[model samples]
Target: MKFLPIFLDSKAGPILLIGAGDPVRARLRLLLAAGARVRWHATDGDFAVAGLDAVAASRIERLETNPGAADLGAIVAVFCAGAGEIGVTVAARARASGLPVNVMDDPAHSSFIVPAIVDRGDVVVAVGTGGASPVVARRVRERIEALLPARIGDLAALIGRWRKAVHARIPDMPLRRRFWERVVDGPIGASVLAGRSDEAEDSLQAIADPSAYAGASAPGTVEGRVTLVGAGPGDPDLLTIKALRALQDADIVFYDELVSPEILDRARRDAVRIPVGRRVGKPGIGQDAINRLLIDAAKSGQRAVRLKGGDPFIFGRGGEEIEALREAGVACSVIPGITAGLGAAAESELPLTFRHEALRVTFLTAHKARDASSVDWSALTDRKMTVVVYMGTTAANAIRDGLLAAGRSPETPVGVFARATRPDAKSVVGTLDHLPALVREIDGGPAILVIGDVVSHSAPWRNASPTPLFHTFQMAAE
Candidate 1:
């Protein structure tokens, strides 16, 4: 909010420079590299930086100490560095002459501050903290540098060359926008990134004329992409960066019941939201219906996102969705998220795997237990193996019986976390025998069951103070 960002057309004319310091030399190099004619006015003669000779001969000019008002008239901008009292005077004169002035380290005197720039030719990014913190701004620029590809600027230049032609081909504003997006984000962009500029140009032109290149490169027809994104364990923070991008890019998001509202709120504001939430005992749309919807949307060239809570592959019916997409010839990808068990571990500060205690961890869903009688409950009874059950609140009694019948001890420590990582999250600490009775108390909220010796190390157990559970999963008034 402190500074409004604007990219100047520096190549318009010569830029005025007043100083003899090292910083001034660096600024000269940048100005010259950007193809700006820099007219330097310094008390001392030496105007040498690392790559001074690399710049063209006529690009730079060394002038006498004091520049006249006529000299400032020819310059587009002025930068003063380490001129001491002379710097202040020059700043005043530059302002009076109605030119944008930048006095190094003096925000008050300067009309503009040069930001830490990530110069990718046409794809330039500038990070500025309004001269408040240059170091912080530089650090932010570094992070941006990592996220952007090296050839991104080249890719942009490739698109720039075809801009006028594309405009002529697709005149409608919305259609033109869609055409550019598809070309830039699809095969043409990929070709540019891979150093195939010729191929990229061909792709771009092909996209512009779909009828001619319909079979070879149908860039006009963008395929619908389905991303199965995980909305991690009720915490928006736990969502992966890739998942966030998918949400933001989604044209239509088909989310489930377990996904939190906060996570859904991160999606593009104008994106269509369709709730296909399916919970036990709830009258809801089936998986088949959801698959059909996803296929239909994708076929219509819409970017569809199937947003689910936690890791999509882990008992989330994500495989089923992938299979359905494969059968329907729609492209689908998965973005992983922190499941409830891992989220509960962080929230409770309990290690899922301890060296001497629980060494292995297993995640299961009682609701989707295909063969309950044939389930390997006996192997799960091992004390060293921590078992996490999702959607088991409704079948807690059956789970309790199954484990107990498999010779698992009734006194085994069990922890139930409801709405894990959420502000109104609740927990119940008890033994395996207490699970059946405890399940009757918990109501509509999504809950996870962690049954292991590791539960002994959890926060509720360590604190030894639990909100007593009342009938119907309601807490008695304190």
Candidate 2:
């Protein structure tokens, strides 16, 4: 490192400002704020002691003529703000006397340079290019000021107050770090950032005792279990706190085919991730084999988490897995996440139920609902009934024929939501007569097709900035 940067504890000794100039006044004020006893030895009266009368302790005259052997004991730092001969003389004597000294506008002569400091009450950020460029340093400080809120210092102060108590209670390293990370970066952090001191204290006290927060969330016994958690749609912002906590505590994660990488990034760092994926028209691991894997992992006492995309309960076959775990006498639980149909509907601004137009909503899986007894086709065929189908893309023709044969109108408006809730979520809209072809045209993954007269009530995006909500068509969804 070319520049030796250190924060002087100004409270330790006196700050000696040797010249009266613009630089001298600024440095003097900073030292005063830092609780330093400042004294000036300048002969000039232009930049006088008008403002420093009360703040500065003394402004005495130095009687020692030759500074090469001057008594310079009992000093923290010295600043020479003069331009030519005096600046060089003061810096030389101070450096020779083993004192940290700075000469203004001359890097070669100085042992220390004053820095651009951002003081946030408890938090201080010092920016120094070591006299390379002060203008650039100030500009960088202004940008940092914009990104940081005023309450961050208050938050830091609160942590300082509670650190002793927290340290006394938490002796384990990993658990303490996890607790602090949640308190400082999770909802509690947001509460403190909004400047509610009472709320901050309440949250801090709640998590200070590890057992108080870890009972329900943390693993109690060495006997391992798997939690099947849904990662929600593409947006990480949409993930529930339960899902996030599960990811935090996971030892190993076995993820699904369709789960987004953004969601997986939230998992614990030490946790190993294995892709137990299934792709379209591909031979993947069978359900029985996956169940055996989970059972085997649990039998060996490993915390295995089976993570899936969207609501695991919806079309994820999570029930069958749970049943299989029960049969094998293994412990397991499920946390439902935001389903794709609901996420897409909300983003697309489509009302699943309207006043007498579409009074009932049905969510049916095309692949699963097609087995044994078919879906309540008669009820689904009602004009007032809205139907959301998953895994319906490949069986679009079969589904269209079934709905029409069950007495649905050919003119019933329908929409197919492709890759719902993602950045590039696409939708195909047309009457029921034209839906199969419309579904075929769009080849995106995991499409949710909505059927009923209510589909005409669904909003359309104009592919513009800040897409308007719930518009029929530019001509009609106005």
Candidate 3:
């Protein structure tokens, strides 16, 4: 990020404002509303607080001295608008003093850029595009303004007032946080937001044991649990709302190697991230060890998230993890994601099921040749069944041999889609007879193989020219 978003304490000290015109006026009002004392040097010498309140106008100290020589000792920040060359000079001076400065519409001369603000009393949202696009920032601010509750700030103020009491009642840090979470998510916070602060206060005061209200087993102990989140097909946007919330709430995350960095970034900033899943050819912390980690994390009162790529239930070993967590008496829940097969199909426009041509869709894995050989290929030989093979890159030949040997036609269309919904995703399409060759054309694994007549209807299949292998296979069949 070009600029870090921060809420500067406006009451810390006076802000030196140097400028004129509407932009300066707008910034002046913003600073005043934020309760900042302003030392104004209106370059045009019109220091009129025409529309401002008497209280706010009284806070502004109009400076007759040249702003370039003005003492910046007690100033916390500097803002320049319509000051032109003088703004640039003052910006350089502020930077030398190690103070944050902003030259309106000029990021090159500024240490900080003002963001579009969504003000909800105590709850303020700042939307910034790093000075690249103010319009975009404003647009984002509008969306945030719409989503935030009108009285959400009132809820924050209530929490602030009761924070010390809650802390005193629940000394354990985790347990105390839980207490506030319960208040904010439960009826007490709702009452405050619904314009019944008195009722909310009474309800809160009536809670005999805040620890009990916060779901603490003992006076100081907090309950911890595991949330198995499905990170969908390398796309952060594809994550389920619940999955995103789980990530945001997690104290620690044990993520698969296939989970994209973008998806990992969704987790809470302070969350402890550990890679536990196996990579392409490298072994990982074994599943048993991973389970132990999860159990231990929860037993220690930390919210743990097992972030797996794609849908947890779809060949993701989610069932095994669930069983392990259950046996360990750890509370756990799952949030499903868009699996790689479905992601690949959607991206490539490869219909897994088509009316009479492809009726059934079977998802299987062939991580190695032995795995492919052991598969019940006979059952998958039906012309109308679409077979999606996961982790089949290494066992491509084995898959072709097994399917062809089981009377699945070599003429069956197939598409090898790699990286699924990721930006670098690639697809190769041809007859099943050239399945191994098709797999070879892809850049890497974490790819899926779609086998069925319906593959011929995919975008890649239609767009691709017939390869020599496809031509050769067709000739042999002819």
lDDT of 1 by residue, 376-471 (tens): 798898989998988888778778888999988887878787888887677776788888766554444588888888888877776664432221
- Candidate 1's displacement at residue 460, Å, is 9.3
lDDT of 3 by residue, 1-478 (tens): 6778889999999999999998899999999999999999999999876788799988999998898877889999999999989999999999999999999999999988899998889888888999999999989988888888899999999888888987887788777877888899899989988999999999988999999988888887878999999998887888999998899888899999899998999999989999998876787888899899999999999999999999999999999999999999999999999999999898777888999898899999999999999999999999999999999999999999999999999888888888888777778888899998888788677888899999888887766665424321110110
User: TM-score: which is higher, 1 or 3?
Assistant: 3
Instruction: Tell me how far the alpha carbon of residue 86 in candidate 2 is from the true structure, in angstroms, after superposition.
Output: 25
Which residue pairs collide in model 3, if any?
A: none
TM-score of each: 0.60, 0.56, 0.95
Give the runs in model 2 whose Cα sits over 4 Å from its true position: 1-221, 368-376, 461-478
Model 2, range 1-478, lDDT digits (tens) per residue? Answer: 4577788898787667666567666666677778777656553644454455554535333333443333577877887776357768878888888889888879899997777788887788888887999898899899888878888888788878977777667665444555566677777778888978789888777664463353224433245688999887677888899989989888789888888887889999888898887987788798888888888877665667899888879888888889998998889999888998888788778888999788899998875335313765777887888999887887777777788888898777777887777766777677787776777755656788888777666665333223222222221121
> What Cα-based lDDT does every candidate model obtain?
0.79, 0.74, 0.88
- Candidate 1 ranges beyond 4 A from true positions: 1-6, 12-19, 39-80, 83-113, 127-152, 170-225, 233-249, 252-300, 313-334, 346-449, 456-478
Predicted candidate 1, C-alpha RMSD = 8.0
C-alpha lDDT (0 to 100) for residue 221 of candidate 2: 26
The best candidate in terms of TM-score: 3
